[model samples]
Target chain A: MRQTILSISNLSKTFGGVVATDDLSLDVEQGELHAIIGPNGAGKTTLIAQLSGEIFPDNGRILFQNKNITMLPPFKRSHLGIARSFQITSLMQGMDVIDNVALATQANDGHAYKFWKPARDDRDLRQSAIDALKEVGLEGREFEKVQNLSHGEHRQLEIAMALATQPHLLLLDEPMAGMGTEEGDKILKILQKLKKRKTILLIEHDMDVVFALADRITVLVYGRAIASGSPQSIKTDERVREAYLGTEGDLNC
Target chain B: MRNLLTRKSFNFAFIISVGLLALLPLYVEMTGDDFYLDLANRLMILAIAAVSLNLILGHGGMISFGHAAYLGIGAYSVGIPAYYEIYDGLFQIITAVFVSGVFALLTGAVSLRTKGVYFIMITMAFTQMAFFGIVSIEEYGGDDGLVIDTRSTFGNFFDLEDTVTLYYFVFVSLLISLFIVKRIMESRFGMVISGSKSNERRMQSIGYNTYRYKLVCYVLSGCLCGYAGALLGNFTNFISPEMMDWTASGELIFMVLLGGSGALLGPLWGAASFVLLEEWLSSITTYWHFFFGALLILVVLFARGGIDGLLSKIGLSK
Candidate 1:
């Protein structure tokens, strides 16, 4: 029996009469790889924003670990075991990969305000950051700064940062967005491995990756949850076909 | 080992520079050049101010244009208490920091709402407002400036009335500010600021409340600047509303840009260069402001990251 780790109830967000999310409700089960699939501007990013506490919905309730957390700040949400990776690669361009990952680890540690002892000297935090880097197959690239890393490597580093938080649920936005087929396959392998331990809410446009990995898929169109179910069910839904996945559908998730 | 050598070279250069500066007062004393010591003292004080700005601008990626206002506030922190006959040095310094900190917190909360150039403009506007408010105080010297009647006393711990002692005091304050900033910039909050500077929206999605992080940096920067201002008041034996003016703020910002915003030692270099340039220019020509202003414009136009950025680009920077 899979328990729900997060539950969104009747959530809606609008920006100046443009509805971003409309009466959306969903439950993310523990240890499940649930993917949210939609065309561009389908409120997917907005939903992620609200879930991650970056944006507040006009009306909604977010329950995480049986606690109401709609108004919680992003860091608090992260502390409570919800970690997210951005669609756009966002890493400190000046700092090395290990330093970046160690920063994320520092977030959950007792006090980042302690300034005298060098963070590098702390073996425990350093080891965890190293462990996260190795988990993402970025072991040897620890000393490389984000700017020097390839685009695929930046994406991989994003995952490594998310893992450093020791999150129970990883909300990954477009992990394979800019990757080539080879790079995509590499990420798919990483996601496959991660799914075994962490409950993941993946937002991806690649239907093949979506269908291959998502134990359940939710299709969103024009800020509405048009259809949701198994990949086979969503592929056959008529409303979803009209809203998206019809003749003009290119799966720009 | 090359990295170790580079680091050692940086330390050596820093020590040499400080040694040279410490000996400057002796030259002034021997040559009867009061102006030289005065200018050097001004540079040291501004260097302290610039170091604080570096905490926010370099480490946090917050390009605050109004850091000078904190200096103004800090000057008043000392000036106000002394005017009221409450001239305890430590108390005045504490008050200065508290006032500036509160101001920064409130302003940062509103200003940090916008990012990029918008943040800079909002901060600049707030500082101007502070400047104007001080100017409007007719009883407190208003537009003219307030003259301190007595030197701030620290329970006979040191004689600030002695110019040489005061110079060393300013030097020690600069060192302490640098030490504190170095620690804060290397801490976890510092990491968050660095991360947010790269990508704030990404930070949000990762569950870091970047707004709060930025606010903290702003307040810290303001408090340190206040310390500089209080020291400036004691060094000058006067305080003026002009200390809070936009030009003063702009010059401090220029110091940051000229030295290197990111490097710890950059602002000190910048302050030294800026004060020396002004002194030299004034000696050479009466129209020094015009010439110096033109040179500064050129620096801003051609030098993207100031002298430090330029050196780093050419592989000469630390």
Candidate 2:
């Protein structure tokens, strides 16, 4: 039996008069790649933010591994093995590429009080960071400054940092948002390998990548999960067609 | 852009400069020309203050404009006790650090909640409050300042009454302060502080409670600045409300920027360059502030990372 790794119950959040997430309930099975698809302003990023504890929902209960994580701070959420990547490529700029990932790894270790030994001199820490970079195809670019990287490389570094955290569940917001076909494929392959071990809640706009990687799909419209099921069910659901997938009709992007 | 002032490339400059400083008092002892010793002492004391500010301003991305308040607090720890004929060196040092630490914890709890310019404004306001509070105490000479007739006494083994002893005291304090900051900057705690400075939001997502780290950094900085103030009190034989004015805080910041804010040895370099510039510019013209302002703009525009960056760019550091 596949246990639910994460369960969100009746999540509702509004920014002033505008509703961002409204009465939404969702669940992700263990070791499954779940993709969230929605139009622009459909509260995709907003949901990701709530899941990552960047913002609290007006009302909701977030359960990770059956533990109630509602009202927890972002760092607390991170401590409970929930890692996240920002869609806007939030990274530690001016730091070296490997140093960015190493910080994330150090964050996972959660022992930041030691104030004498040099962090860079820790070979174990450096090796793990290097491993994360190589997993995302970013090896040999360790010493490059983050600002010096290209946009696509920034996206890869974002994933590398997330990977460095060594989380049980990964919350990714538009991992392939600004990439050429080749770079997108690179991330797709990484996600395929990652799903075998970690549960992923992915927010992506690229339909082709969505169909290629997701074990299941949830279609969101105006902050509500209008339809959700296996890829075949979502593609054929009539309400999903009218609310979000109307023009796209086919599952093959 | 090339890597600017990475720790790997800084050994050449820092080692050479510190070595020169370490050997300086010997030259002074032999020559009896105590002028350079006095100047070096002043810059080194100020350099310690600058370094403390850099802990928050550079690594933690906190721009505190009220740092000189701790300077006053430390000096008063010496001055106020001495006013009653209580001049225990250990008691003065303990009182200075304790008071500044408490002040930092209280003020930082409020100021760290603000960001950017608001943070800067709030810190300056707190320092001004300290300045005004000291000014109102009529018993301590108030606006006129208090002069210390006797220096701090450490039993019998180490007496600060000797001029050379006091100079060496300041010198050792400067070296110790630099060493502590340098070690902290490379440690795990430093990684989090530096990372938070880069992107605080991302740091939270990565499991760091950035506020606590920054607050701790702020307190550490304030306490160290207070210690520097204690030394200044002993060296100058004077303590006044004027020492903690907001402009004094501004000058400390100026030293940090001129040296290289994030670079480990930047503040020391900054204090040296600032003192030399002030001496040289005033010698040439009375309109030194105007010339200094123009020079600040030039350094900020072209040298982004300050003197250390310039040296690294010229391949002189590596």
Candidate 3:
């Protein structure tokens, strides 16, 4: 039996009168690549926000390694090994690619109050960043400024940044969103490799990638989980088809 | 723009500026131009204060409009003690650093919680408060200010009596301030502060408590500016509520931006330009400030990195 690495129960959040997350509960086992998919306004990103501690849920309990982390701040959650990539492509636009990843690596290293020695000269930090960049196929472009990188490169950098944290669970909010087929395929390959070693809770809109990558799939509609199971089970669920998946003819597989 | 200024022209501009400052005393001694030496002394002190401002304002991306309050606090550290015959330079320097550091810690704690225009307003309000607080104090001479009968004395270390001695003292302080700012920016602490300025959310999500880093930087900046104030008090031989005025703080900000806010040597250039322009323009006309204001507007309109930006682009092209 696989151990549950992350557990969320009765998670709920609201903005004014609109229910962004309505009594949502989910769980992912160790090393499982769980995918959450839905149409627009399905609260997928909102759910990721709560999990990453960007915003607190109205009511819920989040257990990471059996520790309650629901009220923890974002940085504290990061320290606990929960890393996230934003849907809007958030990064330090001023810094270069390697330094960006190096900063993320430095974050998890230890206290940063060392106000004398140069951080850029630390061999261990730079090496770890290089390793993460190489993993994301961004090795040769380490010196490139983030502002000059293409959108696809930005996504790759985003993944590299998440990986540099050495996180146990990566909450990737649409890693392949707005990418061309070539870029999307690169991300798919990276995710395929990552799934073997890390537990990733991904939110993606591409059904083919979802069905192709996720070990387990959860269908969300209007902030509620309508269906969650293996790929074949979710593909046939009547409620999921009516609410989100649509006709089986569109599955294309 | 990365280091608050481009690195391209840094070598060219910084070396030239420092060389000139280093040779100024010898030139003055040979030419017997004591007036110019005095002017350079005042210029360097303000430069030290501006450099301290640049640390938080430029690299750390914290806009503090109330930095001059620390200047007043530092000056008063000397003025008040000297009034009662406490002339130990060690006590004065420590008081300047400790008192201003504490003040920054308290005010920065409140100021840093805000952002954008509100941050500017709240900081200005604090300076106004400090200004009025001193104005209302009768024992410190209120608006009339205080005159120090005897300058601060160090125990056989160095005396601040002679203008030449004071000039060297101020010069060394300026260099030290620049060195400190440079070291801090390259340090691990500097990286976090710069990262926080770039994308604070990213910094937090990456597991850094950015608030604490920024607070420490703010306090350090305040302490350095306070030391500059102590030197200012000694130079003018006076202390007054006028030292902490919001306008004085605004001038400091102007110097930072005019020189190039983030570049290591930007403040030095800014303070030099301000002093020279003020002196030259006033000598030419009674309304010389009109021309100075116009010149500043022109620089703002034309220069991207202020003086640093223009020079870097030139350096880039060549």
Please list all clashing residue pairs in model 2, or write none if there are none.
none
CAPRI tier of model 1: acceptable
Model 1 chain A: worst 10 consecutive residues (lDDT sum): A244-253
Candidate 2 C-alpha lDDT tens digits along B102-125: 999999999999999999999999
lDDT of 1 at A94: 84
Q: DockQ numbers for every candidate?
A: 0.45, 0.64, 0.59
lDDT of 3 by residue, A1-253 (tens): 9999999999999999999889988898999999999889999999998998889999989999899999999999899999999888999988888889989999999858888887777878889999999999998888888999999999999999999999999999999989999999999999999999999999998899999999999988889998999999988788887887555444543
Q: Of 1 and 2, which scores higher on DockQ?
A: 2
A-chain TM-score per prediction? 0.96, 0.97, 0.97
* TM-score (chain A only) of candidate 1: 0.96
Shift in Å, residue A44, candidate 1: 2.7
Candidate 3 per-residue lDDT over residues B1-318, each given as its tens digit: 134223443376677767887888889889997898889988999999999999999998999999999999999999999999999999999999999999999999999999989988998998899999999999989999999888888989877998888988898899988888888998788988888989999889989888888999999999999999999999989899999999899899989989888888888889999999889988989998788678778877888477777777777311
Tens-digit lDDT string for candidate 1 (B219-254): 989999998999899988878877877788888878
> How many residue pairs clash in model 3?
1
Q: What lDDT tens digits, residue by residue, belong to model 1 across residues A1-253?
A: 9899999999999999899999998999999899998879999989988888888888989999899999987888998999999898877788878888988887777466665665666678878998999899998887777899999999999999999989988999999978999999999999999999999999998888988899888988878888878888877777777778675553434
- Stretches > 4 Å off in candidate 1: A14-20, A232-244, A247-253, B1-9, B84-87, B114-118, B136-138, B311-317
Fraction of native contacts (fnat) of each candidate: 0.53, 0.85, 0.76
